[model samples]
Target: MKILYILCLLISTQVFSQDDSFAKEYFKNGDYEKALFEYKKLYAQSSSNINYISQIITTHQQLEQYAEAETFITELIQRVDYPSFLVELGYNYQLKKDMAQANLSYRKALASIDENPNNVFAVARSFQNHTLLNEAIIAYEKAMVLKPDYNFNLQLAQLYGEQGNIEKMFISYIDFAEANPLSLGNIKRAINDFISEKSENENNVIFRKIILKKLQQEPNLLWNELLSWLFIQQKDFKKAFAQEKAIFNRQPESLLRIEELAAIASNENELDIAKEIYIFITQTAQDANTLLEAHYNLMQLETKQSSKENYQAIDATYQELFKKFGTFSQTLKLQIAYAHFLAFYKNDTKKATSFLEKTLELPLSELQKAEVKLELGDILVLQEKFNDALIYYTQIQRNLKNSTISQEARYKVAKASYYKGDFKWAESQLKILKSSTSQLIANDALDLKLLITDNKYEDSLQTALKLYAKADLLSFQNRNDESIALLSKILNEHKTEPIIPQALFKQAQLYEDKIQFDKAEANYEAIIANYRDGILVDDAYFKLAELYENKLNQPEKAKALYEKIIFDHADSIYFVDARKKYRALRGDAIN
Candidate 1:
């Protein structure tokens, strides 16, 4: 008997759900009379269902039965003490063009909030639902004032923003952020809509003044952090550095934020400020790891700005660091960087090779060892020891299978094969790597695969492709002049080949490396004019746009090119960056 009872109950509940769904569907389809009939039936069965009651009222309003809706709401208010029904009655009056009655009903809802502050939630939400912004604001504020423990700053902030009250919105958001610190990221993202890259933007100025005034009233590290962030946004790294220093002075436990700011500055080409920040880190950091990172970054900055004459001094500084902090696993990155510097910068492969091999004797994780081996493989390839380099790369592949480093090692393996003119093997390797978890590696693999497949059959001997690969190898070895000349030969001799665009792009990069911006511009223009459908066209567009913006002082040209990427190549990897540059150049008020 109990089993039969359970089955009956299940069937009844399923019928109930189906009936409710049918009623909602009818309402959604604008079959109001049927919806009203179904809703009334459900309400008859479940008299306490608020959803049914609300839907009945809304359906009546939708059918232009405002008088009926108001009567039903008034009846509900008298039967139940639910204050939100007053809002419904007011909305019905509004639909009927009865402004006086609407105001009276809305005032009754606000008075309900005064009687019980907890009623503010439903009251304000109802007001917002009806697009009554002013009433919603009053409801929230009154409740918060009456009940000190109630907090509705987030809601108030949104309402103020909608009302174009920027100052009040900022204050409310900041107050909410102060109360709930973890929401800082969310608040900043919301605020990002109002500010621009220019520090002098009106909204930016307003926000800065607000933060400054708050800082004066109560000096908090959060304000300094925010100021630093704003300065970084404006590309004013010098001021950002000062703010970061103030933060570090007050809370010297970690240099992580300062380190991040320095990295941002470096990426933005603010090398002097980056160097200064790193130097501060080196001087003030108490931990060996922090000091080492600072020294390493400082050396990198020096290397970037240094000429051949500064190599000897840079080498001495490396030795000084080694003497201070002994060679160990902790200093592995510095050691690897030093090896790259020696091999690539100084062209001392023998010494660089020996140094890395010695460093390999230290205790390290497999991933760490893979990092060292990756660099060592590069040095070996630099020395033209292709087979030896393959051994190390294959070991990493075997040990750390499917990891990003493993994928990197596999890419190196394919690169090594390509450099050695083994097109078939390189293509095979690249084919497998097209699905690499890392987008960068996958893109690179696809590009190389396309390069080989496109040109391998162009000549019976594959002469042009081989020469192109050799040029690529030379570029990897930092022999930019040779690579440029070889690529020029490809352009001159293989003008009709599909490889022309790729060759031109490669040569343009090499020219840029040589500081020959005009030549680079010419090559990029060649690709854009002749090979609009080529895979490298978007790349050419972005590179040329960057050159125009930074090196050539042709902001108008840059803006035009960025506009192309924004509209034409939406799927290009450079789309986001292009859009950002486009907006910045256009002096957009918001990002």
Candidate 2:
């Protein structure tokens, strides 16, 4: 008997669900009378369902039967003590241009919240749904006052933001974040819509002042952290560093935040401040790993700024660090960096190769070993020992298959083949890597594969293609001047070839690195003017826009170029960044 009863219940539920779906479909298809009939039938079967009641009311309104909708809502209010029904009734009155009755009904709903604080949620939500901003705000505020434990700051903040009450919105958001600390990140993201990269932006200034006042009054680390975030957004790393230091002093448990700040500054090209922060870490960090990382970052910054005359000093510093912290797996990155410096910067490939060979003897994990071998392969490639480089790269692929490092090794193998002028083999390897797990590797592979397939058949000897590969190899070897000159040769001699645009783009990058802005501008302009239909035109537009904005101080020109990428090359990889730059240059208030 019980089993039979369960089966019947299941059938009943399935039938009801089907009925509800049919009602919704009717309503969606604009067959309102049929929808109303179905809804009434469903409501008759389950009169206690608020969804059915609400849908009945809404369908009446949709049919423009305002009097009928008001009557239905009034009957619901009489049947139950539900306060939100008053909002429906009031809205029905408002639709009929009876503002006086609508206001009276709304007042009754607000009064219900006074009798029961929990009604505030429903009442405020109803008001907000009806676009009654002031009533909703009043409802929330009254609830919080009557029930001190109640928290509606987040809702209130959003409502205030919608009303354009910026100060109140910010204060409420901060209050909500203070009560729910875990929501701080979400609050920052919400607040980010109103601020810009400029420190002096009005909203940014307002946010900063609020944080400063909070800091002065309460002296909380949360305020400090927020201040640091704001300063970082403004690219005021120095002020951000100050805030980070204050937090570190009080906490003293971690330098992670400070280390992250240094990296951010470094990425922003605030190298001096990055060095300052890293030096502080090296002095105060107790953990061996942290100290080593700080030293490594500091050394990297110094090396980036050092001239050939200062190379010996940088080498001495590297030796000192290795001696201070014994050569082991812990310092693997620094060791690899030192090897790269030796081979690439000091032009001592023999010593760099021998050093890495010794370092390979260290106890290391598979990934760590791959890291070392990858650098070794790069050094071999630098030495033009392409076959030898392939051996190391192949070892990594065999040892760590399906990993990012393995994919990187495969890309290296393809690149080495490309450099050796084995276009057929290179194309095969690159085709395999087009779907690699690593996006960077996939992009590189696709680019190299396209380069080979595009220009290889243009000449019987593949002369222009081979020359392009040689220029790319010179770029990898850090021979920028020679790379630029070779690309110039390709541009002059291979003008009619499809590879001319690629050469021009490549040379423009080298020119930028050499700080020859005018030359870079000319190269990019050539690609833009002559190769408007080429794949690299978008790349040219974006790079030249950045050059004009940052190097040439021609914001209008940059804006126009970015507009080209925005409107013409929607699928280009640079489209998103170009649009952002274009908006920032145009002073569009970012949201």
Candidate 3:
């Protein structure tokens, strides 16, 4: 209880001491009324200061005790007439909102200021306080002329802007920009305001042209971005691209913004904008992976119809891209995309073969290799290389193990045998594959099985000979496309029949005939890759090698297929052509 009493007493003393400190600060700063109030609180206890009595008189005048303060000043005037003190007496009238007397007080102050303009700002502040803005402006102008570096012009400009004097406001912003052109936030806001106002008001619209000229005079990165959007709004893509070059050059971080803009353009099929953006991505992005997604998006957006010509250019583009990205092989999407465009658009069999072959040799997992081998086998079969097609299918069969693709490989093996004229063996394979787990394969196997079964009761040999005769007539007339189409229809119409592979082989040969090497290579390789011990393996290999060597300009490339054929199929029909070409390309001294 005694300790509590002492703590309370100490806290009370501290609070009173703090109040006295604040009272002294107010009194010294000349806010006498507030100081007087604080001092009176202490004076009630034991105050006896003559200065405090003098302060009470000053505080009365400041508090509008003009009658009381007049008597107090009368005695002080007899002792000394301070000019600054006289100004205070006059300013007190103004502080009481008596404008007329305040003006009188300011005039008396100026009576001494003719000898000195140093107090002009103080007089201006008096006029400003009195709501005499015009008079204040005059005084400020005079003071500025005398003391040119007055920091108050910034405040004056702000006042003018608030008063809606736009011309002066515009000039102020221009001055600010001149002093600090790098203050982008302020500059952009000011310019945007100017643009909005001018665009709405016809007479003010001239400001747009003026500001545009200024923008062109200094083309920084922000200016570049702004101008590019401006040009785009004006429907000028070429100019937009030209302007955007500065953005990447000056501010590389802006490339991400460019991507977002380009994506918007691409969605609208603004091909020109999308193209520029895609190019910028490859150039400005820190890593190839950064733009790889955009590349894939572009690949998806690319259609076969409208952008066919663009699709055709994918090979050369990918080759250049490979050079840029160091052929890292991790970008499997690039491989898939390149293969798609090459096989469908370029019709380059050897290129497709080489591409898929290299893809097979990549550090891909078993699943990826299996997937790519399926593509490879299809390409081989399209080129009339049945045996090579069988090799791919058989590998998938062994490698894929329990995979659904492995089940589908069984049907492909049947197709390979049928193409090689092994109808009996092919039909036997198709019978088991008829109940394939895959609906498409099952349907195909069933069709081929049915066609063979249906024909067995009739003159099967005669009907097939007729189909072959009709296909040959189309080929003879150089209607290779029509023949290929016809053979495809036959395969589709009689899918499960033993004659499907014969149709497949004929269609593959027709693709080759029409120089549709990609499709032809697919059919040929499918045959060789899927039907390992099938009959057409020899013919498919020889023809595929011939296409590679002659049409595809691939001596080294053709050698692989030919060597495999000669090594694997000694009793095959095209052994002669395969052997001769192999020797010629390899410079093999054949005994």
Candidate 1 lDDT over residue span 9-106, tens digit each: 35555556656988989999999999999999997886556678778999998899988887888887877677788999998998999999999999
Error of 3 at 348 (Å): 22
Question: In model 1, where is the ten-residue run with the lowest total lDDT?
Answer: 1-10
**TM-score of each prediction:** 0.89, 0.92, 0.32
Candidate 2, poorest ten consecutive residues by summed lDDT = 1-10
Ranking of all predicted structures according to lDDT, beginning with the best and ending with the worst: 2, 1, 3
Candidate 1 accuracy as TM-score: 0.89
Weakest ten-residue segment in model 3 by summed lDDT? 194-203
> Is candidate 1 or 2 superior in TM-score?
2
lDDT of 3 by residue, 1-591 (tens): 423533543555555554477677887787877887876666455223333434555667656677666555455444443233344556566566777976676566555445556666456655555455555555555666666665355445444555666555555555455555566455555434333211234213344344466677875454465556545543456666777776667766646666766776676557766776777676567766767866755555553223456654655667776676544456776776677556545667688778887887778888778777777776666665779989999999898875778877777777666655556766887887766678788777886666556455445463563454356445633457777777777666665555555676778777874668888777778777776565566767777787787678877879998898788887776676677667556653211
Decide which is better by TM-score, 1 or 3.
1
Q: Candidates' lDDT values, in order?
A: 0.89, 0.90, 0.62
Pairs of residues at least 3 apart in sequence or in different chains that clash in candidate 1: none
Segments in model 2 whose C-alpha atoms lie over 4 Å from true places: 1-38
Candidate 2 vs candidate 3: the lDDT winner is 2
Model 2 C-alpha lDDT versus the unseen true structure: 0.90
lDDT of 2 by residue, 1-591 (tens): 423533543565555665698889999999988899999999889666666777888898889989888888888778777788898899999989999999999999999989999889779989998899999999999999999999999999999889888888888999999999999999999988777777777777788888889988998898999999999988899999999999999999999999999999999899999999999999999999999999989999998988999999999999999999989999999999999999999999999999999999999999999999999999999999999999999999999989999989988898999999999998898999999988888988998899899999899999899999999999988999999889889888988999898998898899998999999999999988888988899889998998898889999999999999899999999988888778777776545
